[model samples]
Structure formats: C-alpha cells, structure tokens
Target chain A: MITYDDEVVCAPRAGTLYDVLELILDRGMVIDVFVRVSLVGIEILKVDARIVVASVDTYLRFAEACNRLDLEHDVRSKTVPEMFGSPVAKTVGRAGARRTARSLTDKVRDVLAPEHEEAAEAEARTRERAERPRSRPAARPRGEDDRPRSRPRRRTETEDE
Target chain B: MTAPTTTAPESAPESAPESAAAPKALYVYGIAPAGIRTPRSRGVDGAPVRLLTEAGLCAAVSAAPPRLRPRRRDLLAHQAVLDELAEQGPVLPMRFAVLSPRTDTLLTQLRSDAAHLTQQLDGVRGCVELNVKGTVVPGHFADLVRRDDRLRTLALQTRRRPDYEANVRLGEAIALGVRREARRAAREVVDRLAPLAVRTVQGATDDEQVLSASFLLRSADEARFREAVAERARACGDRLALSVTGPLPCYSFVDPRPASPAGR
Candidate 1:
C-alpha cells in the first residue's frame, strides 16, 4: 500500500544530505595539527550507494509509485506520507530534498555560531586510532586522511604498517 | 538532528580516546570550531566522530577499533557524522572509511598543514555548497510526440491497429524519445550552471539520480543563485524539474589528507 508519496515522511528530496553530503565530509580544511579517523564500512558505501531521485527511471518509478498510491479513497485527502507505510528510507527523492534544505540551514547556524567552539576543542584527539586502509575510496570526495580518527599519533591504521 | 555531545542519541556511547591502543583509531569527518554540538549520529561502524578542537579550530572525530570496512550501517554513519558537521561551518569532509594509523601522525599532519588548512577553512568561510539537479520529466513526451509529425502519424496508425505488439513498439519508441530528450537536457543543465559556480564538480548519476553536480558559492550569491535556479525551473519546467538545494557548509573544497612519503 505504501508508495513513493509516502516518502514525504522520510526524504522530501535528494538535496538532503545526499546533495551537499559530498561537500561536508569531503571538503574543507585539514589542519596539520589534528588527525582524521577512519570510518568503518565506507567502501560498501560506494558500490551500493543509491543515487538521489532525478532520473527518467525515477520519473517512471515515480509514476509507478504514484500509480500504486490510491488517490481515489480519501474522504478528505490524506497526507502523502500516510499513504506509504515507511515514510523515512533516507533515499526517497522528495523527502531527501526537504531534509537537505533544513540541514543546510542548520549548518549555517552552527558555522556562524561561535558558541560550540569549546566543545569541538575538548575532543580534539578523542577518536584517535579507530580503523584503517583496506577499502577503496568513498563514492564521495573525502579529504586525504580517511584513517580512523582513533588512530594513535604514531602510525597509520593499515595493518601492513 | 545535531550531534553535540558524546551522549547524543545517534551513536552508541563510544569507548575513550585510544591514543596508545594498537587497534584503536580516530574517525575524522570534518573540522569546525569548539563551540558546536557533537552530532547525534556516529560515523561508519557507528563510532561517533566527536569534536576535537585545537588552536581555535575543531575536528569532528570518533574512535575506531581496527580493520574497518564498508557496511550498510557504516555508510549511513559516515553520512550522519557529516550531516551533523554541516550545521557548524564549512567542514573539510574526509572520504568515507579513511582511517589514520595513529594520533601523532594525524596531529602532526594537521600542524604541518595548518596554514593550508586555515586557508582552506577561510576559502569556504561564508560559503556553502548547493546542488542543483535537473531531471527529464516524462510529461515532456506528450509535447514531443505532438511536435513530431512523423511520430504523430505513426502513433495514430498504431492506435488504430491497437494490438499488444503495436503497443509495445509504441512504448519502445516513446522510451527512446524520452532518452534523447534527457541527454540533451543534461548538457543544457551543465552549460547553465557552470558559470555561476566558483567551483564545479560532477557527481555520479544513475537512472534515478540525474544531473548530479555540486557548486561552491559565496554566501551572498545565494540570492542570485536562487534567481538563476528559478529562471531555469521556469524555462525547463515542462521538460525537466530543476531543484536547487543548499547554502550549506562548504564540504567539497577541502582536501589536505597529506599522503605519507611512501603512499605518494
């Protein structure tokens, strides 16, 4: 019974984290003073990574998904998400757009904010030496140091090292 | 939505800093100042990328045990960490699953690259990333079919015959027409957006995600960019849906993962 319309609850559009996500985790300053921790399961992210909805396939899929959404039965037209069982799959095109928009606004607030700077300082070396190199690069552009943030100050996380 | 403290909900309360542990590692998603929140979501492996600030700047990082690889939950985790960081300022995002072998090395790298890092940070100071996507809307086919006389006659003839084989052929033809239109529209999108971008990067495109692109713009450019997007939407609304997202932290322009002498 759930169709793409139900996506309103999950992703409103692809612009959510899906759009600028490449920018946030992949861009910016890499100070020579701090270490970047490697994340686990980052390689699988690339191969299985589903692109945001913006394709003809998506249009057809959307049409098909819409077709599945019984528009006829509403005594008083129901909210779109209510039509779909799972409204939050992180990949729904429309839902992603709304979420990404909201997230960007929040990022701006955080950046201009001089308040949280202290908290960021406290954990400067916190995750040092978590994991290391074994996988291919991310589907998104990432700064060079993909090593586990938990890596110690002495060596890289690659087992070979 | 925001990850400010370790106690934040997304990531499990991670173990302490593992500076000396062999298997221990730190996960750095992006850099920011010390004033922001610790994202509620953790990085890949569900290990939180917490804030680590020094010399006025902060790094969002997490603890890693060892031998990390890509997994479904982990990819989401990486995405989540950066998601939280974007709320701060321009985050120098790292690729997914990049692990540093040691803390000393990381700190040293950050220090060595401090000037460059600062410059990169400044580069995106008041800027954010915006991704404007344009997809071929199937509705355009109606117009295309009407405009093409050869196709119109063929369609009329097919309609008169009205057989399963005929329908399939008609549908196939329509699909082809749609593809041709989509490809043309894609070229047009790149042409239109390229001039407005301070930096432009192409993103991956699948059947569902078409016209994948990222643009870095100054904060003030938000208005002009939106105006351009609006104009594009009006111009191509029938054939494509042009949607713009952002005014977010500059995440695509940072890369100083200084390669070690041997790796380079």
Candidate 2:
C-alpha cells in the first residue's frame, strides 16, 4: 500500500536540457535536402545515458540502502516518515531519488566527453584491479574503449565519403 | 560540468574548410508562417537569428555553425529559437543540427514543401507539448519487501550471513521491487492522463525512470491536464515521483518528415 504526499507533486516546470533532449535530437522535421550532421558522440552519449539505470552498481546501492532498514519493526506500519526518520534512509529519500534519476544524462555527457574519458579510463583500470576478476570483463571495458576509438574512425569514414 | 569549450579538434577541422569557402550554411531552427518577428534569442553559437520567407512560409535560421555537437548551449539555443517562434504561431521545428547547404536550396525547399510544412504547423496549432517524467521513489519499497514472503526471507537470510554475494542478491531483489512498483504506477499515470491529451507519445524509459511521455494538449485544456497530473502525482507519490514540463513547442508531436506532395 503506497502512500501519497504533497511533496511528490512537482509543479509543471520548464524543461531542462535532458528533459527535451530526445525531442530535440530525434523528433521534428528533417528534410532530405537538409544535412543533419552525423553528430559525433551522440550514440555514445545515448548509450551511456541508458546504461546508468539497472546497472549492477545501481542494484548494489539499492540493496545497501534497504539493508540499513530495521526489519524487526512492523513492516505494515513503516511508511515514508519512518524511512525518513533514519538518517541513512533520509539520504536515500526524495532528494537522492531525483538526483539519481536526473543524473543519467549528466553522467552520460561527462562519460562521453573526451576529457572525462581519460579520467573514467583511469578509474576503470583501478576499479578493475581492485574488484574480483569478473566474467564479463571483455564486455564492459570494450564498450567504453570502443566509443573513444571509433569516434576518430567515424570522422575518417565521413571524410572519405 | 566544464564551460562550453569548442567541440573536439577532429570534428572542428572537417567543418572548418567548408565554412571558410561559403558565406555559411543556414542553421534552421523551425518553419513558421511568413512575417513573424525575428527571434531575439541567440541562435546556435550565439549567432543572430533571422527569417527566410518563401511561399507564405518562413524558416527561422541563423548562419550555419562551423561545428555542430549536441553541446548544452547549442541544444538550448535550438529550443529557444523554436520557442520564440511558437509564441507567435505554429512552428514545425527542425531537428537539432539541421543545416541547409545553401540559402537558395532552403528557399526552394520552402517553396516546394510549403503545403506540407503549413499542414504540419496547423496540426500543432493551439497545442503545447507537456512531457511528464516519472522516477522510482523507493519510499514504499520497505513495504514491498515486507509484503513479499520471498523478499522477507531473503532479507533475513542476508542479514544472518551478511556476505558480499548475499548483499548483492538482496540488493538486486529490492531494486526489482522498487522498479516494478514504479513501472506499475507509471502505467496508471499514463492511462489517467492520456484522456486529457489530444495525442500521447511515449519516450524511452529505463530502470530508474519508468515513464517518459509527451502529451499534446490544447492550450485551453493545459490547466485541467496539469491538475490531473498533480492528482496522479499525489496518488502515486510514494512509489513514483512525477515531474511535468510543458507549454512547450510541440516537438514530439511534429512529424520527422512531412509527406512529400507526390506521396500525399
């Protein structure tokens, strides 16, 4: 049984860049004569944007938050107030949810940007070394490395065309 | 985020030579009826926006930018120009980064496609696009975990063992529960709000954001529609957080390519 709250009703607000991004990028008219520039990094940006959701990291974060709950307390009585009563749960509430949700595009933008790629690569290397050897090593890093490398290759291909 | 630096070097080089030769390609923002006021807002790269009219239709355009990336400023500039046009009357917004190689070609296109373009403008007339995005709230997630015997059992098991693998499994189960509730709320929201809209276009939804939908509604109905959204938001507030952005130019409602006269 979900409860309703006044705070959850966000006013109709002006759209942010992420809010209107797909509309601007994918929707609207594109005439045949018009040249729609093969925007470099857009694919990478989009892929990275969607990747943040449903990832193992996000699952882990969710589990960690839930683990802090005092399960001995009557679950039926527990609601938003009780969740917010705990300092840990308060951090995982509204503000945190909005931040996590909206951060996808920003994260994508940061991850796809060339400067951030180097930093991300360094971080990934360190993370890989620190974590237990995983089965899907080839799959994860390949996607990241491919974007930066393929960008240059795409430019050359377009030039030749 | 870093200040809007110019796009990377590799992209700059290719576009540079082409820009040097010509006056500049026209970066089209949108199509409108001829005689609308020139947009005061800056175009992409802060270019001065002007209009090109032909066959009773006008395309709000600026000098073609040297390089076009989906930079934050440029994307906002594109929306701003269309928004300015949309205030005056109907506009058929061009997708971001659309450029005409030459002004002559653009004029020719406007002339040839006038009927189709005008029809598209009419389709969106008196309507605004309200995009509603709903994200998982996780407020009632504890209730879910408690209600489901499997989840409760898993929680107890994980608490007892407290190993990394157990924690991951427990976390994954909680994540699924959170998303399932949010997604359920998302469906109910869309169902409730769909009636108020003339048309509804669903956008991509991921695990965190269970709903991303654009609703096209008459300007007159906008208030009622918003009230309904607020109601739904309150009803599902604990499981999903809803945000509405609107009175926007009808970007999602617009056709990507207007049917050519021959096809029509």
Q: Give one clash count per candidate, in the order shown.
A: 122, 1
Clashes of 1: 122
TM-score, cand. 2 vs. native: 0.74
RMSD of 2: 13.6
What C-alpha lDDT do the candidate models reach, one value each? 0.48, 0.67
Across residues A1-161, which tens digit of lDDT does each residue of candidate 2 receive? 01222233232233556666778888888888777888998886566445545556555655654665557765223243223322212222322223222354443233223343445444544554465233221122221221222121101111110
**DockQ of the candidate models in sequence:** 0.10, 0.22
Q: Which residue pairs show backbone clashes in model 2?
A: A63-B171
Q: What is the lDDT of residue B112 in candidate 2?
A: 84
Cα RMSD of predicted structure 1: 19.4
Q: Recovered native contacts in candidate 2, as a fraction?
A: 0.53
